[model samples]
Target: MTLLADRHGRTFPYLRLSLTEACNYRCSYCLPDGWRADGGPRFLDADEVRRLVSAFAGLGMWKIRLTGGEPSLRKDLTAIIATVAATPGVRKIALTTNGCRLSRHLPRWRAAGLTALNVSLDSLDRERFRAITGRDRHDDVLAGVDQALAMGFDAVKLNAVLLRGINDDELPRWLDWLRDRPLALRFIELMRTGDNGEYFERHHLGADVIEDRLRAAGWTPCPRAPDAGPAREYSHPDYAGRIGLIAPYSKDFCVGCNRLRVTARGDLRLCLFGDFGVPLRPLLREDGQRDELMQRIRALLGHKAAGHFLHEGKTGITPHLASVGG
Candidate 1:
């Protein structure tokens, strides 16, 4: 199989697939204005998703991550996960969720060959959690985290968006929480995206500040495991797990980007901050012409930019994070 490489010679082996634009919680940073809980946007059906995964896997892609405004909202998520996991070239199948509904489905997903999970938990305080997620589901999320750890998946990660004057002060608390667990806690910097310019200006906190705080608390830098993603991992001498930072603005983490994003509607985003993408839903619905579909996908990969333009003054893309699959 031919590898999917762009003009800059970076090969993409990972795919972030958005299952739907619908979400239950209205996170302050993700969906500050609130969103429709009942109906918002439609998504590709299980079969269509399977076909796309097969096509990507045929091109040497091995990792597949199912993302969404909230992936757990989908009724057929387990079937989707099973389909992708059964695909020949796919080696890992993971999901990123708010974790509100993950507890009930953990066993089924694990049995279906799920390799990892990334749960979103922004704060440890109950009131502060409600303030951040715009919902009082902190206990539900924590329950899901407990379930994930109890199940013993290959890897389970917790993602937190760091905002100044918000959950930023809870960094030490988060580290303390991670001290006993085997999970990896990652703090992500806020990106100035689409309609979030004002929000970003008010809340964005650099990862450097988070690192200094960790250093002061006695956390030591450590080498990242070979299979690790974008998070710059660190550890403490006394802790059982590690802490990570994902600083997209203060640092250029795109030097070796090897992933592509496909929205639920089938638009392939080569770069997270770029507006250009190629629509593949219509093409996938065509007659059984797998070779032709593969050719088009390869051609599109060539157009991916060497790096995003966020560092050069571009605020963000036109689509919001919810629609863009986070």
Candidate 2:
């Protein structure tokens, strides 16, 4: 089995799988106002996902994250989790959800061997949350968070997209909430992609802004978790868990990127902000092609550009962020 290493010798061990392209929340960032009319998305079947995960896990891939418009929307999500959890080389199985449907399936997911979770929660205020997500289920998301904690998910991460005039004011409240809660909170900068071009232009808050806010709030920088993304991790004087800031647009971490994204339809995206991808479905379906898949994956890893050019004036000739990996 060959380990996939990039041109810079960065080991490619993390795989982020977009289980489905459909999502419940019509967030203005990734998708436009009416995405269905623009174009329909192709979702992968459970068997195909299992096969791909098995092959990659065999090729030195260890960490797997199930993402989606909202991964929990998949009816067979638990089964998928079980398959990947049972894979030979897989050591960690996690999910990134919108938290709208987490409460109902927390037990099932934990039972299926999910070790950690990353839930998207931009605002604490109900109306604001609804306005941002275009859904009126903020309470349900909060309830789901509590249910996940009760279900004993080891690491419960809250991903907050830091919008300048929108959710920026709520940062302190989120930090205060994390002071007692055991969950790790992450503040992510807005990226320029999909229908978010204008939104990102207007509300792209960087790490410096967040660091200043944390400093004013008397918070200090802390060590980042080993497997966490490029978030500038931090902690308050007496907080239980930690806070992280993912500044992809303002401060790119592609130099330390150890992960790659595989779209639901078998497209291998070397970088999250990459415009192009190599299709692996055809090769995967061919007879006696496991070695071929590894070769293609290695080739794609070598082609992994320096970084994703998703900032202003950058273009990714591929699908939206939702279709790639949210």
Candidate 3:
């Protein structure tokens, strides 16, 4: 069996699958005006998703994360979760969302075998959150996080886009909140996408902003796991939660890239900021095509680039993070 290893000796043990391109929040850093019509094909159906995960599972991919503008918009989301969970080699099932509907659907989602969660929570202040997301669901999102904490998930991560002149100074508020919650809070440095260049320039805060504060406040670096996401985590004895920084601009950020992303339309992205995507949906129609599907993916891995060129102002075809499951 061929492991999903690239030419650089980097292997992918995790996959991020986009279920839908639809999202509710118009996040300032992402879908500021909400999800727009991209005129692309419809998202993968349940059966297509099953075949997709099955092929990846056979290639030693153990972790599958369902991402989207918001995954809950799909009516068959529970079915999607069950399908991924049932795949033989897949060990973890996770989802990343804006958390507006988390509490409403969490009980069923967990019952369907979902294990971990990542919620986009850009602000701690109610009004600020509303301003950033263009929705008044701050209380709803926090309530969902609280419920997820009590539900015995493997882990629940809170993601905040570090924006200058916005939520950048809320680290103290986050630390105070994390003091008692057993959550993993991540501060992701804002990245430049195709349509958000001007916005990115204005709001993009260096992750060092948080790293410096974490160090000054006595947060020590924590060892990373083999299949962990691109987060440099830190912990402190007094705090119950952990803090992480997902800074793509960092010198060595892509050294531990262990995952691949599939867009909602079934296009495989080698690098989030890669210049091209290979369409995989054509081979995902039947179980009998598993061999060809895996082979196609294995061959493409050899072409995977060492890293992204966001520093050069080239964001590929990614108009927004939601489109490619970012």
Best-performing candidate as measured by TM-score? 3
Which pairs, if any, clash in model 2? Answer: none
Where is model 3 more than 4 Å wrong at Cα?
none
For model 1, how does the per-residue alpha-carbon lDDT over 262-307 read when each residue is reduced to its tens digit?
Answer: 9888888887888677788876775485677778888888777767
Q: For residue 62, what is the lDDT in candidate 3? A: 95
TM-score of each: 0.94, 0.93, 0.98
Model 3 lDDT per residue over 1-326, tens place? 44688888888899999999898888888888888777878889999999999989999999999999799999999989988988899899999989999989999999999999999999999999999999999999999999999999998999998999988888888999999999999999999998898998898889998899899999999999977999999999999999999999999788799999998899999989988999999998776999999899988898998888888889998988988879
Q: How many clashing residue pairs, candidate 1?
A: 0
* Model 1 misplacement above 4 A: 37-41, 216-218, 225-227, 313-318
lDDT of 1: 0.83
List ranges where model 2 is wrong by over 4 Å: 1-3, 32-34, 37-41, 216-218, 286-288
Question: Which pairs of residues collide in model 3?
Answer: none
Candidate 3 residue 10 C-alpha distance from true site, Å = 0.9
lDDT of each: 0.83, 0.79, 0.92
Q: Which candidate is the best by lDDT?
A: 3
Shift in Å, residue 198, candidate 3: 0.7
Tell me which of candidates 1 and 3 scores higher on TM-score. 3
Query: All candidates: CA RMSD in angstroms?
Result: 2.0, 2.1, 0.9
Query: What shift in Å separates residue 146 of candidate 1 from its native position after superposition?
Result: 1.2
